[model samples]
Target chain A: MDAIFKDFGKAYAEFDGYNLAKTLAPVAPEAQPDRLYNFHRSTNFSSVQKDFKSKILHNNALPFKLTSEESNGWVEVYCAYWKAVGEILNAEAATKTHNKVSWGKVYEAWKEMTVVLIRGYTNSGFQAWTVPCLYVAGKYMRVFAIKADEDAANNPSSAINFQDDFNPEAEKNEKLEDAARQLNRMFQICLSDRAPLEESRKWGIYNIINLLFKTYFKLGSVSLSKNILKALQAYRGDMPPLDNFPLSHQVTFKYYVGVICFLEENYVEAEKHLTEAWHLCHKDAVRNKELILTYLIPCHLLTTHTLPTLALLSPYPRLQDLFLPLSRCIKKGDLSGFDAALIAGEDEFVKRRIYLTLERGRDIALRNLLRKVFIAGGVEEAKEPNAPPVRRTRIPVAEFGAAISIGSKETMDNDEVECLLANMIYKLVLFGAFGLRRRIYRLHMKVCLAQPYPPPIRRDFSGGTTSRT
Target chain B: MSAAPQSGSAPTTNATSSDKNADPAKDTKPAAALEEDDEFEDFPVENWTQDDTEVPGDNTHLWEESWDDDDTSEDFSAQLKEELKKVEASKKR
Candidate 1:
């Protein structure tokens, strides 16, 4: 058995994983008096090899065999080896790398051993739960990303941060994030099916998406902006639909998406998504809502074709100076400045969005229940009779603002809150909240009329709404 | 010809073609079953379908016969003994 195995490896080392596969056709030692019955001589080697190769090309990660049957186990093992092959492929893809094979071919041979394991210890392999090699192979992908980033950081032409219209290279980065996000989809499917072993393997794959987003944003790259929204949809599907996520997650998600929309120049949609996120954002969470809202002002003003009055700029004092240059850019439609702003601050804005999405999803249910108690007029048990006159005051202005921002923390009952929300949604229905947009419109109109020159009608839903939806 | 097997996601032309190959109970090309082709797809070479019987490198380096009497082969034992003595000598010296 040892000699035959060694002979097989020696014979197959030169051919890439596929050519070596052709050798399977001749492994019928069974017809001879001397044969090792350690493998299945069933399927044609070419078909098996081709199937294994295809899955690896699509995803660097492959599922380990965990089924009760031999046929399924073979399929899983084949997928694992193909993924290892993907690693070598990925490394070959790096520029300035040398072509060749060496001691590293041992990994490829280990994949071949899966054939023996399935034929020899099919049930025991499943029982022993041997890990598939895809785990090792997938690490090469992260290594690829880090290497590419390091290269780009040192290159002069790579100065463009984030996916601006100027940076054609950003498209490839977007594809990488898309690939990572796909892992989350597979993980949820495994979790839902109650396959713990399979699910654990997929965990790293999905987490890479999160890590990738963090990495790209940290470098001021806007590559994850679009893909993260898609990932949010994936996360949204994992949790129940339409419930408030954790307040914190909602805040961050809203802020980042808002920033992306601002960068993308879809001001109306950006503002809507960001506003919805803000309205639902938590109080205890960091003031990303404020930051996102600061950017949102530019989004709104640009879209509405109105100038920010000195009075209106009072709320966001930190932004007054930065706002002027952007205002000039917006006035002239200087896209470069907007791109620069996004590229310069892409990380902080994007991080805020991710943090908000998780926070929103996590606390949506809790916030709704908490809001119920507040709406039901439940108060902190009457402060022990005579605790400083009970403060007998109306809601603080800040608390009122907080209550409005945290959509679930209102004094209104569920029905009233629902009614207000519906009114906002059905603006055409002539509901009171629906009329609120008309006021936002009138204010914009007035501001435009007062200005010497105006660009166009700016919609409030400019940035946030467009980015998320 | 077809949609390139969804770039690794779906069974593409390769899989479809292989489906047309020999028996299911005993595969003729088992090495293809362990395909690393998808991994090294651009290796400037591909699987040896009947259409591609002529491989690039010298295929004459036969190793199949080496296994005929490999069980009693003294090469591995002698190499192991030499390796052990080297380590033992290094420790003593």
Candidate 2:
């Protein structure tokens, strides 16, 4: 202590009182001026009435009002919508519940909330902190809640009354091609009017489309999915990045295309879009990025069959904790463990395609056989017959194995013959037509066989076969 | 003439006043000029024109000082107008 004090004394004397005061003078901490908040007021029935007026409603964007209560109004609205959704669901005791939940009340709550932000800020001019989010949240909450309700009701054991939830029949919901068209038109409207107010514009057409995508997915509307693809493709006319807009919106053209790929079960294309979307998603937006990547990992695994281990995803050191478990489950072929990891991902709070167990579990289970084809020294190495059996390709096995992260070097040696042959034959059956990819895959087949076989992997489930053995 | 000397004046006062109040003849120690210059010397007019990063943080006043050479405000505004025109034109395309 004396040595340190002497060193400091030699360099800088202890600041005298006046000198220290000058050095540590108080910073002018910015004090925000008082803001006007609307509280203790009854719901504005007149404004809700005025919503239908010609003066307010323009081109299907019925302007609505949302009051900014001083304390936790946004969260309160969310809770309110949650209640509304639950009430509608509880009423389903007597009704036929076949399709996904409609969650009309929650959707209505979201719609009303958007009206609040649009009305309060864009029209009446209040601060646009998170009212728009309520709109998006309510919309998707409605979709997922409805879908969950519908699915729950349909299951024999967990059967809640479906008839009361909503009146739509499963076949009718599918048959109503026009409903999907209406969803497109709704998105078109969301995208149609350029928001005059920059803040309200956060709930841009892109945001609405994303909400619709999730909602429609929840409803199991394949028809809606196809329409979303068309709308997205058409909407891809160039867009300049808006001021203060997040990076996710920057690559949205690619995003919608990826959503389409996921629906079509093109795991490769899904991963391509979803990965870009996840990366392009704002770094601080903790939940949504996690949600998107949750789907992306499985897509990477499904298409490539390689799980990104802790080492690969370490740059995002925060998510590395979740990565290890998810990767472990996939590599070990522990379905339940994989399912646990899918839920265990740090971003369970966000509603997205990849993170949600409902979407990813079944998809991964079905796609594992497909992804197992391209391990570095594993499946790709085992069955090499035609070529001179080089030890391994000069193109570093690490280069090809880059995306397909397998921690166990032994996985390559474990089940080489079965996984590789399965990969080859599956490719032969599924994509052997006279296309460029097919031709390339044909070359890949020769390359696949020329590599040495791996010993069979210890598997509870059979590999390389899509069907039950 | 230099920004360093002008801001340097404030810290010099601090040192001189503290030392003078402590004792006048001992205050004749040239620590005021030396100590004051140590902190203020880093912020030089030479640095003002070098690069945006040299200023560090959001020192808008320093940035404004860097462009004080010929009152380029008008020319800068005109250039921005041109950029806006290009933005609008590209959107039209």
Candidate 3:
């Protein structure tokens, strides 16, 4: 393979795009592949031969049976595909769309061209020059995906989010999945090749992974994102140290992992990754920074019972809008107030998908309420003279009811108050003891009151008022 | 959005007053002032769905592929380790 590539490299050395600064100039978007198809294939043979060089090294793992003629033909196809890539990237970046190339059309062309490349390369390995080209193309997938999202958001016809209706992105997924698979194929080839990836080539892998992550996220298939992370981890020693990676990869990886941990209620791990993401995130990328803090703040509240201060939240008004009321309620130990704050921000939190995590912040409210109850209870007298005067740790259900009822408009029943306490205990927001003197649980309510709450007590359904209902 | 910190507990209600005012219906009007909290209890926590966070950017979402914006960023791996250690220490006692 090397010998063939060496020969190919010699014949086309001067024509390689790397050396031809002139070719970097944007081609008129109108003079795209559609126009190229009308030209005689033989007319550009000399120029094609000049341009199709072996700057891209081949992978030895999947060698192809190619005569010189066949190799030259593949080179022409690869060059044509890359040419299309450059044209689209350039046009996409232009401030004004002079000859606005339909991204859908460009994406379609990318798919057709990449299918041929994948089949050929799976049988015979890839060239290193193709790596960056493939990476940039993968990056362009975001543009296409965003365009699809925008179209959905804008078109009132597509705006309705119907549960029973078929997904509008079904066709979009077919295109996105094809693009993602092609990118993954190139990435896998880069990974499994006999030689280690060069420092310059490693960015291609990260770019490919990040692109795939975004595509999966948009598809709402986070399991695929999990698979990508697992695959990347398997190549840990083979790849560069994570610190040496581009910042985009670092932030994206941590953000995904942090969010996944948060969804799973692993607040400890979530806080770790999210804090790293927050610190390393670009200061000026205000939106991205806010996104990081969105999850990070919730993780902090759940794990440490600390709320974002006014100073910390001042700069990001959106965050302040989202968190200010909730923080106030948590600080004040107001269950109803916390619930109110959550209600006020439900739409925003649901839109951001942090509602579940923030919902868990009620545990913080419960903790505060229990703490207040303990303080308000003061010192309970010992039943026996020998018994030590204990701090009012033994809280009656009635006291909890009174405390909870203060901020709540309705009078809560004893059973409802007990259920709330039970939930608090179950969620580990409050810890205490259990002293049940009787097996007859119907009479145990009074006995349980003097004792710290314990789990596994059969709930009384006779009250017909348990809040758990 | 209102920056008022009036959510905190008012200490004017001493133990004696609270005992005297144990009638929940009599005190209900004060709680009614916060009608937002009333609706808050209806939020369905157990049924809340976990979905993906959106990719951040404003309208006209053109961006470059290279992540060079964070050139002077701190070492996140070290910071993560430091944070994890702190959490572990707190958990121990």
Best by TM-score: 3
State, as a TM-score between 0 and 1, how close model 1 is to the true structure: 0.27
lDDT tens per residue, model 3, A202-266:
54566567666666666677678777778878877778776666565676667778877777788
Better model by lDDT: candidate 1 vs candidate 3: 3
TM-score of each: 0.27, 0.37, 0.59
True contacts preserved, each candidate? 0.01, 0.00, 0.00
> DockQ of every model listed?
0.01, 0.01, 0.01
Residue A63 CA displacement from its true place in model 2, Å: 21
Give the lDDT of residue A5 in candidate 1. Answer: 30
* Candidate 2 chain A minimal-lDDT segment of 10 residues: A32-41
After superposing candidate 2, which stretches have Cα over 4 Å from the reference? A1-186, A192-203, A238-245, A248-259, A302-305, A312-469, B1-93
Q: Give the alpha carbon lDDT tens digit for every residue of A1-469 in model 1.
A: 2233333344333322233232232233334311212222222345755543343233223233223364345445554443433433333222113332221332334334433433423243332122222222222333334434443434434455554456555544443353344333433332333234333322232222333344445446676547655654665434333233233333444555666776666778887876665455443222343465565555554443344454444545555554545443333322334345445545644544432221122122222222222222223335667654322222112221223333223344434444433432232211111122333231110011111222333234333121111
Q: Which residue pairs collide, candidate 3?
A: A56-A128, A56-A129, A57-A127, A57-A128, A64-A124, A433-A452
Q: All models: lDDT?
A: 0.36, 0.37, 0.54
